[model samples]
Target chain A: MKNWLSPRSTAGIVLIAAALVALPFVLATGGQAWVRIANFAILYVFLALGLNIVVGFAGLLDLGYIAFYAVGAYAWALLASPHFGIHWPVWAILPLGAGLACIAGVLLGSPTLKLRGDYLAIVTLGFGEIVRIFMNNLNAPVNITNGPQGITLIDPVSIAGFRFSGSSEILGVTLSGPQKYYFLLVALAILVIIVNLRLQHSRIGRAWQAIREDEIAAKAVGIDTRNLKLLAFAMGASFGGIAGGIFAAMQGFVSPESFSLIESIMILAMVVLGGMGHIPGVILGAVLLSILPEALRYGVAPVQKLLFGQILVDPESLRMLIFGLALVLVMRFKPAGLWPSPERKRELQPEKAGG
Target chain B: MAETLLAATAVAKHFGGVKALRDVSLTIRSGEVYGLIGPNGAGKTTFFNCLTGLYVPDGGGFEFAGAPLVADAPQQAAARGIARTFQNIRLFGNMTALENVMVGRHVRTRAGVIGAMLQTAATRAEEAAIRQKAIDLLHYVRIEDRADDLARNLSYGDQRRLEIARALATEPKLLCLDEPAAGMNATETEALRDLIDGIRRDGTTVLLIEHDVKLVMGLCDRVAVLDYGALVIEDVPAVVQKDPRVIEAYLGA
Candidate 1:
């Protein structure tokens, strides 16, 4: 406790806070595109934290987590978009979307309760694809989801007539649309992080970790493993739902393409790469994985042009290749993760010696 | 004589063609350290598992604390005030010694996800009480110094003690120890005998399943011996030891 409040640590915290506050302004100089990427990165942080509750804490391997995100996005699209000719407020839609996604989570979690490990992963993977396919085909019978073309003209998030899409002057500094959304995303992310931290130390958290360690022992200790596992799924899905609501408002669109199998894998990669069961590591993983690909997308063409003096391999494919290589290298070297939790580090210590 | 705390009438179980337990009727009175002993494959563990809800008996049932006990799951058994430690020491390895015990308090604690996230005044107080109780249990097992250590890192004897502490956290009416001294050294086994005595003296009924005849004879007030999944004799320890059937089962025909 004393070391936590030391001058050096306090100074480091203040420095990080200042940097977070100034990040968008500095990126604004590079243009609003970078600010938009930052917003998406924060969105990814929400998804990663949500997934961590299942995969990291409870040790349930879910491969279809993005289905919940899609649920939230479509919920917003149907009720708050011009396509439906309805415009509900943010407060009403956010919770509704979250509730719907929670129900979906429970529906998916029930049958899979008896499944574990790779089998659970396979079931969740099928669930994710099922959602995507439903979103794609639901257009014909009900004209819902707008099919492959997607829904447009979705209303932006607003509080008391103050629109996030519209720029406003604050302290004589004009804030752009993306800048405004960035602050909103940061505030929501902080709230989510607080919830995660609280849950991590609570009795419920301990039960989840117990089940993860040994399910039979946990049950023997009187933990209702089935209900608790369902709670994990519902809670994690609600986070995805909230993030999905914000995402729909930010992008002003809803498309099945945005919530793909690849997106679920990418969000999962964030949780695993950031260090499973560690909050700070997960946030870091999400931010880096979200931003790094964009950075490569922008830098690869120019670097190729400079090095070869001619156009080389496609920049998009090269960006993915580099991303894949980075992931492989990280996993091969730091199997537990780059910033693993202390408990996880201890779990691996003996294995390291034996291997 | 004390009232009956646990009564098993004609409890029978079988696996495939092998009969694991056959009409094993037993009565355990309150506030007594009862011992269940048998040779290998004599259905000691099978009967223990049936009583704890790990396995469903083929016939008959159990009455615990004057109520018919029908537990289909281990959690159900625990909720009915029956706590147990495993033969293989199944502690939550990644959790701290204190946390392992706190998990035992799960059925007693009522904090849900919302209360945990909100950290309401009542929830915070309950959490503190739980932590303090877990710490006290660790102290009871004489491992207060290792309260924060991971369960997996504890010594062999400490792991067994930790499992006992974890079971005690459930505040059970009947504590079932499945081969508690299985892998312990002589000194550790002696300490365990004293702990079991203390637990029974404190008014919690103990049901011990052990292979160590000496420990069982010394600690148990009444003993039941099983041979070929059938009860040979159940009486006071001295009387059971003098029984010819018990000698034949353990020695030879």
Candidate 2:
């Protein structure tokens, strides 16, 4: 049964495809709220996949990943919103946002490429906070981001005169805004998955993993480590940018508050909890974490009422406690993660064969 | 009479007040097993580092294959067909034996990000060729059966041989082996000697550093002795073995 759902199997592919196709319809019956949760989950999947490239493949911990996301969102918001009065199309603005975010990635990566581990993490954390604070305080200098008010009425995604902002009927199937965004996210997520898969098997991918394992050995074997590290950051940030642009267009709102240190940590947690360097594992981690809080928010109060005839603990606090416990337990028992990559699984083997 | 593959002239390096290598020079002829023997702190590894571009000499330079070696980085040195193994084994422990060798073939392969992403027919063919070459290298090192095994899982002698196989994958014209048989038993050491001979027999110049005096004397076509970071003598094995300075250097250290 487990093997049937394993990503390597044909049955698993079919099952996932069938489920993805049916999910929107299933949630549509219950209204847009569940679909919105799924949309956010998909967004987290995008963020996790992007973070996976840096933290997973390249073994570079980037705690400022949300900065790129923020850059991408701001780029989209400014270009396609009433705040700037530009109102560009989604296609035109998407690449620009991604490109700008990529530049930010390179800017951060180039200087910090020499730094590793906790030092790099601390620098990136600072970069993320700096970007947020800059965005927050930019209202006075040039009225760039409108200070803390954030951009509103951002333009929605439109493809070939078909706006995803409103309900649209396709083959007698009516799709709501959340449903439409869910499909788009799934499509983008699939594309990202393909990119991730291709990279994981490529020479560049091998070089990245080799750098992760041993940078000195990698350089000794002629891997141009400096450029490759930049590429990793750029590539990883590009995904974050795409996700950010989509997020801005979907919500029709952009804010510095949205891209916070917590967002970065959550994304990093998704990568770790899923299985660093494992694509499906990362996706699962993102999906699980994204849904877990919402599920707790809706389910915990009712469950508490039933168990004790009154609420003993607030859902928010309970939600965090459960999340923290889950993380700790997972780290303790399954250190490689829920779905570890083959190499990582070998690394975390119960008793490694005696040398 | 043979063409000189590597010629180091008056190479010098110093760490602060201490001279790690002072005026050390040697000429390695094409297709010869050259041995460099020295006691601890004799600067043999330092000279090896200088030749391999891991360390830039404070003064002087070396030429390889009739061109002045401009190896500011190890990659540049590798591009010039000079490959060396570490005194301690440095195989990528996480990777399989086959994958480790493929990394060594990285300089030889030229699939960029686009080609890799697109997985074009050319890239696919190249990747296959690389895998094939890597497998052949494993077979060459007599560890073909353990190709899929993690490098760290390999026995000590196998790991040493794997390092050699990896170095060979670079298709180097000059292979510098730093204490390749350091941790091996007598049988393993004998096997390693044969493998090193086989490597030189395959038309590659070999430069070796070893503490095993008998292995140095028996295997090296020519031997160079260093004392206090300076070359004491460069002669045939018999001549180097009997040198008073070499004897004194070994005993003193």
Please give the DockQ score of every candidate, comma-separated: 0.60, 0.64
For candidate 1, lDDT tens digit of each residue in A1-355? 2465999999997998899899999999999999999999999999999999999889999999999999999999889988989999999999999999999999999999999999999999999999999999998878988899999989999999999997899899999999999999989888889889889989999999999999988988889899999999999999899998999999998899998999999999999998999999999899999998898888877888899987688877886788799899989998777789988888877732110
Best by TM-score: 1
For candidate 2, lDDT tens digit of each residue in A1-355?
2364566797768878999999988987887999999999999998899889999999999999999999989999999988978988888889998999999999999999889999999999999999999999999858999978899999889988888888989999889988999999999998888788888877888889889878766766777788889999999999999999999999999889998899999999999999999998999999999999999999999999999999999999998899999999999999999999888898776434524
- CAPRI-style grade of the A/B interface in model 2: medium
Model 1: lDDT to the true structure: 0.91
Would you list the C-alpha lDDT of every candidate in the order shown? 0.91, 0.90
Span of ten consecutive residues with least summed lDDT in model 2 chain A: A346-355
* Model 2 RMSD in angstroms: 2.4
Would you list the clashing residue pairs of candidate 2?
none
